[model samples]
Target: MRELAGRQDDEGHGRVLERAAEAIEQASGREVIPGGDGELAGELRYALAADVVLGATYTGTLPELHPGERLALVAVCALAAAMPGCVLGDLERELTLLAGELDQAVAAGRAATAAAASRA
Candidate 1:
């Protein structure tokens, strides 16, 4: 079970990296140079600020990334930071609903596991 969980974690991390690559490719199409001197650093500051304010969840992956991938994720967070308050509020509403659903699912899974263990 631990190995399965580890593989799932690895898959999630791989998906994040793959999405970052796609973002870089899209930026390239728009003629943005992700490796421009000091650009990534500047963008990363915004990302960090967003993470602090919004709990954007990028902190875990940022330190392990290369320059290009970091640039991509930071660029995304910067864009999110730039969004209007109304849009952010709408997103918050949606996230709240999803989080509630996830919580319920987790509770159900735990209850099911407990029952199985008691019967064993």
Candidate 2:
């Protein structure tokens, strides 16, 4: 089972994920299987769509979570959102490193886009 990069074994990272998962499940009224969707993707998509529609971050849709816990929840939701019609376990394992790189790309793109928009 491949773990996320920069996840130290002694840092209680797994506990963070576990708490986040429980919070997500409780708030969404859906089961969150780490490597499975269980229709949780639909809920996440809906939340994101709602965010876009409202032009605001909807924190109430999820329980109040610490920053680290929120990150874990976001990561788990991201994995679930991308799992549709794919082998969840394999994808999670295979994309471990690629995901980190993609995160960087995503952050860079966001910064670049925001900068360009500001200049325009």
Candidate 3:
């Protein structure tokens, strides 16, 4: 769990990611295995992150958000967007942190899935 601190965009993401993680963890009351395109889900995220970063940052054309901050911004924006009517004016600082949290969750989830598959 590497923390991306001191760099811009890694701000309020921690809180949002924590919330997402909580939601996910709580939802795990049943260990029902998911079927259909699990790898697609993971690949889609990478594609989505790329799309968001490119669209929001205009293919790195816009000189807005620092040199390495677009990805975090995109992640926070995605999380906030996913939850309808989520207010983001408050958690403006932890955006990158949330992104990192998401990265961790995704990684952990994939690892668990792979391990389960191996045992199958």
Clash count, one per candidate: 0, 0, 16
Alpha-carbon deviation at 23 in model 1, angstroms: 18
- Best of the candidates, TM-score: 2
Weakest 10 consecutive residues of candidate 2 by summed lDDT: 1-10
Give per-residue CA lDDT, model 3, range 53-85, as digits (tens).
343232344322333344444544355333221
Q: For candidate 3, what is the TM-score?
A: 0.28
Worst 10 residues of 1 by lDDT: 1-10
TM-score of each: 0.29, 0.32, 0.28
List candidate 2 stretches off by more than 4 Å.
1-38, 50-80, 83-87, 117-120
Best candidate (score: lDDT):
2
Instruction: For residues 48-107, write the lDDT of model 1, one tens digit per residue.
Output: 343321222543542233223333344443443222222334545643554455345435
Candidate 2: tens digits of C-alpha lDDT, residues 1-120: 012212324334333334333443443333323555434454445542322212223232333232343344355445434434233456456445445643654455345445655666
Task: Candidate 1: give the clashing pairs.
Answer: none
- Cα deviation at 31, candidate 3, in Å, is 30
